[model samples]
Target: MEFLGIWIAAFLTLCIYSFLYRDNPFYRFAEHLLVGMSVGYIIILTIYFGLIPYAWDPIQKAVTGEASRWGFLTLIPICIGLLFFTRLSTRHAWLIRYPIAILMGVTSGIMIPNALQTDIFAQVQGTLNPFSVIGTLSSFEIFGAILIVIGVICTLTYFFFSVEHRGPIAGISKVGITFLMIGFGSAFGNTVMGRVALLIQRVDFLINDWIGTIF
Candidate 1:
C-alpha cells in the first residue's frame, strides 16, 4: 500500500513535470484531477474532521447529560456550518445571512484589535527604540533608527484623510513614499533569490532521488 502511494505520487509528479514540455493531455488531466480531489478532500475534511469531532461529539455528550451547559454553545457553530448548506434551498436562503453576520461579527471583533496591536503598535515600537540614552552614546545607527521612525510616522500621516497635511508634512509624506519604495525593492530582490534557491533545490532533489535511483 505504501509503495502504491509512493508510485502514485511519483506518477503525478512526472505528469506535472510534463507541463515544462508543453500543455499535454497528461498535464490537463492532472490539473483537473487535482482540482476535483482538492474539493472532494475539503468536503471529506469538513464532514469527518470538522463537523463530527467538533459539532457532533460535544452535542452527543450534552444529550447524554455527561457535559455542562456550555456544551450547548457548540450547537451555535454547528448550526452556522449547517446554514452554509442552505444555499440549495430556494426560498429560505436568507437563513445563511444570520450565521454569516454572526461569524463576521465574531471574526472582526477578534481580528481588528489584534491587527492594530500587532501591525501598528509593534511597528511603531520597533522604529522608536533606535536611541536608548544611558551614558554618551550618539551613533549614526541612532540617526538611521530615528529616520526609520520618522518615515513610518510620515507615511502613515500621508494616508490620514481626516486632517489637513501641508508644508513639512507633504515633504515628510514624500520621504515616507521613498522609504516604502526602497523596502519594496529590497523585498522583491529577496523573493527573486528565494525562487532561484527553490529551483536549485528541486533540481538537486530530482537528480539525487529519481535520476540516481533510475540509473
Candidate 2:
C-alpha cells in the first residue's frame, strides 16, 4: 500500500510538472484533482478540528449543565464570521466594514510593536559592539560590520525625499543601489537553488518509485 501510494504521488507529480512543456488535459485533470482534494480535506478538517473542539464539544458540555460556561462569547465570533457573507448582499454590505475595520486596527496595532522590536531594536542591538577585540576577530570583522551599517543607512537615505541630493549624497545613493542589488541577487540565487532542490527531490522519488529503478 505504501509503495502504491508513493507511485501514485509520483505520477501526479509528473502530471503537474508537464506544465513546463505546455498545458493540456493531463495538467488540467491533475490541477482539478489537487484543488478538489484540498477543498475536501479543508472541509473535513474544519469539522474535525475546528467545529468539534470549538463548537460541538462546548455545546455538548453546556447541555450537560455540569459546565457553567455561557457560550455567548462564541456567538460573537460566529456572527462576525457570518458578516463575511454580507459581501453578497447590497443592502447590509456596510455591516462588513465593522469586522474589516476591527481586523485592520488589530493587525496594525500588533504589527507596529513587532516591527519596531524585530527590525529597529534588533539592528540597533547588533551595532553595539565595542571597538577593541582579540586575535582572530581582527580589525577586518569591524570593517565589515561598519560597511554593513553604512550600507543599511545609505540605502535608507536613498529612499528619503525630504531633502534634495546632488554631490556626496548622490554618490552614497549609487553605492546604496549597488549594495542592494548585490544583496537581492544573492537572495534570489539562494531561493532558486532551494526550489531546484525540491524539484530534484520530487524527481528522484518519481524515478526510484514509479520506474522501479533510477535509470
State which candidate has the highest lDDT: 2
Query: Alpha-carbon error at 94 in model 2, in Å?
Result: 2.3
Error in Å for residue 34 of model 2: 1.5
Candidate 2 per-residue lDDT over residues 124-181, each given as its tens digit: 7676553334244668887787787788888987887777878888888888898889
Error of 1 at 170 (Å): 4.9
Q: lDDT of each structure?
A: 0.80, 0.81
Alpha-carbon runs more than 4 Å astray in model 1: 1-8, 132-138, 157-170
Give every collision pair in model 2. none
Off by over 4 Å in 2: 130-137, 161-166, 213-215
**Candidate 2 structure, TM-score to reference:** 0.83
Put down candidate 1 lDDT per residue, 1-215, tens digits, no spaces. Answer: 75565457667778888999999999999999999999999999988998788988898888888887688899878778788877789888888897889989999999999999999888777776555551344677667777777777877876876757778777877787888888899999999999999778767756665565567
